[model samples]
Target: MIQVDRLTKRYGSFKAVDGITFSVGRGEIVGLLGPNGAGKTTTMRVLTTFLGPTSGRATLAGHDVLDEPLEVRRRVGYLPENVPLYLEMRVREYLLYRAKLKDVPRSRRRAAIHEVITRCRLGDVEDRILGHLSKGFRQRVGLAEAMVHDPDILILDEPTAGLDPIQIREVRALIRELGDRHTILLSTHIMSEVEAVCGRVIIIAKGKIAVDDRLDRLRSESSIVLEARGPADAIRRGLESVPGVEHVVQAKVEGDYAAFEIHTKNGSDLREELAQRVLQNGWPLRQLDIRRTTLEDRFIQAVTRETISAEAEREAV
Candidate 1:
């Protein structure tokens, strides 16, 4: 379990994370997504006690991040973007050391290390030097070290940053399996990864929380794509005049037919009306379909909106 209320982190005058609030429930996997420099890594660092927040408060499993940092660390296993690895140490050796650092009991330390090694698929390379391993193997070593202590929560930043497709799929499956037992807050640039393993998504931009919602609900947001052959202006006006249509924007022109994306209100299905309108106007309808909103679409929309707002604020001043 994790709780962050108005969490803010700053470096000099630049605010990295600004007044963002969200929570991850027990056994839930939540994706923290954003563009570059959107404070995703900053937020994770603050939660993991690697960096302190400038203001606001965060608690991990009921332990205050600032006042009870040690307790927080005990409950959180962190795998940063660029994992801090001891290049000379063997995979199992590094995990053994990490287990000790996380205070795994002497009796269970061996068992914990073994479990993580197997779970993270590090068995074959367990005896190999970390520095000599491939990037994918090294990433697995980092994951094993993080899970070596069996912490209640896992804070992973770019867990699959440098892995091949096969390795990425393996890691994604492992994360999904881990979610059954640990509350996970993951940060990554891959939308399909979130869609695959995360039940919820929190999109951050410009140092602020932009969208936080269930993955299914967010993906359920849909719009209509219509392509018709007619005067572009007339087709646009007709679609815009539809009762539930919010607005219509011409996507592109393919010869005589033009594609228009129709954004509707309240996720309404106005496809029938739109088709009739096209027919009434004597325009040949080429395509009319509802396009489900994707995680990437929502991510881009949030970040773009934030960027525009920031620009507007700067211009006003």
Candidate 2:
């Protein structure tokens, strides 16, 4: 439902986004991830029609972002990182106003506003002034306004930015519920948010695309965790000589138990073999479990690799 092709955005001599391309399919939730100054917001702005790309193209639901901006806007619901809201207005009143601005038919405006209020769980605060609401409520109000028009695609940037743990969980749950019906392109610096909600991840670094793949595949690329109740050196020696184990890094030695993060070749599962070795040696086994790679790991690896490659290119030039 969303497509970006070699898109680039520049401000004077600086390139905020450089030749990045990706797409979001119908009913898919994709996360756009990056550190600060990593061009994530730039790319989202170009897609939302707030900024034009210096060169290249982007389309939302078959309408060219540059040529059919109005049409694109009609199909897209964007909630920026800092949601712009009229604080003095009541929640319901503001949503009604946004519905009108989005060109929701006057005849159906009431229904549209009601639907979003319900979807965003704003029933209790619908009549409360936005300024008096908590930060979490205000965030929900912003979300309600964004989807008041029931657009085809939802582009949310940092949807759970400043909320406490409870509020963050609430917002993440709502986003997941929305994903069932909307083609969502989520952008955030929170790795856990992406891990919790996004099916695919796109990591951008230094104005370029770094990694784009399914979340499951990325996690499978991480190392395994193995711990045993034996001498640290003995455990390390046994694991090191294992057929599939490529590298072993000692983690800790607590009492009789020793822990190591085992990097195996081709993402192998060697739990059974490791346990059998421990049993053969008559060493007590404490814990032999997989510590699945997290989204944070994949993100760090991507950004670090990109930085290294960029430095190498600059040196060669």
Number of the top-ranking candidate, with TM-score as the measure? 1
* Model 1, residue 38: C-alpha shift (Å): 1.2
**Model 1 misplaced stretches (Cα beyond 4 Å):** 228-237, 250-259, 281-286
- In Å, residue 279's CA in model 2 sits off its true spot by 14
**Cα RMSD, model 1:** 2.3
lDDT of 1 by residue, 201-275 (tens): 999999999999999999889999999998899899999998999989899998999999999999999999999
> Candidate 2: minimum summed lDDT over ten consecutive residues — where?
219-228
Per-residue error (Å), model 1, residue 272: 1.7
Give model 2's TM-score versus the native structure: 0.83
- Total clashes, candidate 2? 0
> Whole-model lDDT, candidate 1?
0.91
Tell me, what's the RMSD of every candidate? Answer: 2.3, 4.2
Each model's lDDT comes to 0.91, 0.90
Question: What lDDT score goes with residue 310 in model 1?
Answer: 85
Clashing residue pairs in candidate 2, if any? Answer: none
Which residue segments of model 2 deviate by more than 4 Å? 224-265, 270-291
